[model samples]
Target: MKFYKRTETRKINIGGVIIGGGAPVAIQSMTNTNSRDWKATVRQIKQLEETGCEIVRISLPDMGSACNLGKIKKNIKIPLVADVHFDYRIALEAIKQGADKLRINPGNIGSKDKISILAKEAKKAHIPIRIGVNAGSLKKVHNFSDNFLRAKVLSSAAMEHVKILEKHSFQDIVVSLKASNIDITVKAYKIFASKRNYPLHLGITEAGSIFSGTIKSAAGLGIILYDGIGDTIRISLTANPVEEVKTAYSLLQSMELRNSGIEIVSCPTCSRCEVDLIKIVAEVEKKTSAIKNLKRLPKPVKVALMGCIINGPGEAKDADFGIAGGKNTGILFKNGRLIGNVNVDKWVEKIISMIKDYCR
Candidate 1:
């Protein structure tokens, strides 16, 4: 039921997780914990992994943090990506410590000879390198007056780095072209994909707080992904990294591109609404958050929670299961048929029970 044709690209494995080459778009998040504190980093990574994060990146600011890569990798189930900058030596150290992939900006990672050295070492380890180019970090294109021109400049910068790695006979690469602005980010990715078949990682860099960041990322990423351009994605929110993973899966699910976890289709209330819809929806979400590995379900268990009967019956019938509220009672339905009514107080408990049964 995939609606869009994916752009074929070279497949690259991050540890055992694959991206591109018609593989499912991988979800990634970065740990905000200090890498040198290997214990804390491991704890955060484990949390992300349990929340369905397939790959995790951690900052390697110095040799101290680079030395902890093995410790972090050993404790986590997902692939570990090392974020290194300025020094090529840190990149080499990260490789030595068994980083599944390396993220670097060649523009600031020293000279061509140093990059060649790092490239050779990474080749030896059979690990991929991500050339992450952020608009804020780009040395060129200070004026972003015209988004198309900015996108061209951004794509050029990423190509320059790609060529450097290619020159060294290193082709295991992933590329990310990111900007805070949706227009520039979408345009750059479209431009880059048309030029190379390398796997592209998508994101809106420095996207703000959870509320706004989710909207901005969805709007921007939706455009690029719907066009069938990106291979992997991260919704970079200023909030906890776990939220980032949740947001990523939700976005993919909305497009019917992925099926994992609970897909709640609820309505915004109005005067016609008789029940406390806001409170009910919040309670449902909070309770369901404890349901781990819903991804194991054959598909997302579609759940609809509506505040009024006007459109409630239709929406409830449309979902795998749902509750259409009226007064203090709700009409529960499953697979388009009535399942009898339940008190408002029992909605959360009933939905949780039905979901577990549905999954089983």
Candidate 2:
């Protein structure tokens, strides 16, 4: 079954990139560096861009950092989003200095008048606004009775913010309702997605360090994207931002929604096995990390390096290329047909060369 159906909707341009209404799912990341430090911010953004991040968000904590948007925009190739909290003036200044998008939680931005001014400035600059609602920052009226209730409250708060922007004739908007709790986050997004046409940014806010965060993000994002609920995704982690980009792509790959770079398919060595499958897979992964521009293989090409022939060849019959173990020799196969045997000593080198040739 097709996991997603294209929805007819309006398009919002963040910098030169357009999202919504049948656009490719965009990947986004936030800068952890000090935004006021122009050199550091620009350097981090360039690194994210290099990793194929389509959009970057930076915190504008004060007027000084808000002023740095011009320099940051000048140096970066992707859209720049200003994450503003409680300060309408910073939102205004961020736009004046050329921010391509503004992320503001109107529920905390003080008053209706302030929300109006922020919306007007964003509308005047023709920049989209993202109404980011987090469970940690939800409105006080929410009782937090149950997971579903909390989601409902958060979703309502987000829609209210969107209406405030809409009041000022602002329609270029996106919405994100985030919660640390996986169930609540999923429910909140499903609730919001059902009622609105705005592009939703999917994430599990404050998902912990690398191992746990990756699991949490993959589970939460995997479920939502499969249901056709996400337009863009950010895998929030306490680890380095680079990990976020990697996790986002992995989630997309799991859904068969997209593919980027080399996808290694290997097997676990058993008692019947020979040859070091673990080391071989690791070495190949490290070597191919630099080739990111290859087009997706015409089909899903599996490269299997299995440990035993008894179950190996049959298990990997669908692979584009494969290797099964012999005593001190490894037999390579293409489309399940044996090609040749190579000694264990030269197996890693042979596999690496084969992958490079395939990529070429």
Candidate 3:
């Protein structure tokens, strides 16, 4: 349950949020909005913050987008990181605009002098830089002649960039070695962690649509985190970035790494189900999602929605509150003990009301 003792790494502050060094693993998501539109980016970021995203990354594809960091940073509560590639100037402009962190590859930025200049500026600003190495782009630096060398190649390329920053005496650094393939992603991070203690940003890149991507991310991130190899995570999906945050929280929650919202323990409808359990669960989710963002709540609440006796109360016996569906009726219970039976139509509302009062 302790997840391999949470490997200790150097602590670095992205804005005011501390990551690594035994801190709680932070959830991060990137904004898909065009960065030049500061207002739009701010809007999306606020949604991310509301959904419990602690760090937000936005792309700085050009100077114009880089210039908008100050404006966007002013409107969001979470720390902002600029994702920069190929251009050291955009990285500089992002820093000057008050970006909390920079994700850049020193190797890809240019010559030694350019990297040194950027590192010096970042050092003066007291900000951290992430050496992001992707499997797709790393081929330029190393030969991919053998599949067995992929993980080592990825880790080595990242260290090569880290050396560039270290040469300039810049130590505030984070690193990510991501590949679309889960096995490769996990191996890359494991190999890197074995070699150094820098904080790692984890994800299965280009991880498809929400349904498929969630499964892929969970499998990859689950194993990596179980090994205590990640300090932060971004569950990349092709859907809305908010979905990314939600999926990240779900993954973290399952790993017992984060406990932020109500945990639903519902059994999939079976042949024994005698009521419209699907509709009831959907309604419960919709209603809870609304109250989940309320300013005040004692703590996370777990509610079970069961359809039959086979695994209903027995399986979810620890649920704070729950209902087992029946023919036009429901059995309300608390911690597996029978409270009473009620009309199925009122089960959702009654459970929510009781939870609201208990939380108060």
Top candidate on TM-score is 1
Q: Residue by residue across 1-360, what tens digits does model 2's lDDT show?
A: 356764444678999888877676788999999998999999988888877788999998999999989999999899999999988899999999999999987567778788888888778788999999888887552576788988898898898878887888889999999988889998999898888899988899999999999999898888788777777889998977877887787678667666665555677788887777788777776766565544345534457878877877788887878788878888888887999987877777887777767876
Model 3 spans with C-alpha error above 4 angstroms:
1-3, 140-147, 292-299
Clashes of 2: 0
Off by over 4 Å in 1: none
Poorest 10 consecutive residues by lDDT, candidate 1:
136-145
* Models, CA RMSD each: 1.2, 2.0, 1.9
Cα displacement (Å) at residue 86, model 1: 0.2
Better of 2 and 3 by TM-score: 3
By lDDT, the best candidate is 1
lDDT (Cα, tens digit) per residue for candidate 1, span 65-105: 99999998988899999999898889899999999999998
- For model 1, state the Cα shift of residue 308 in Å: 1.5
Ranked by lDDT, the better of candidates 1 and 3 is 1
The alpha-carbon deviation from the true structure for residue 351 of candidate 3, after best TM-score superposition, in angstroms, is 2.1
The lDDT-based order of candidates, best leading, equals 1, 3, 2
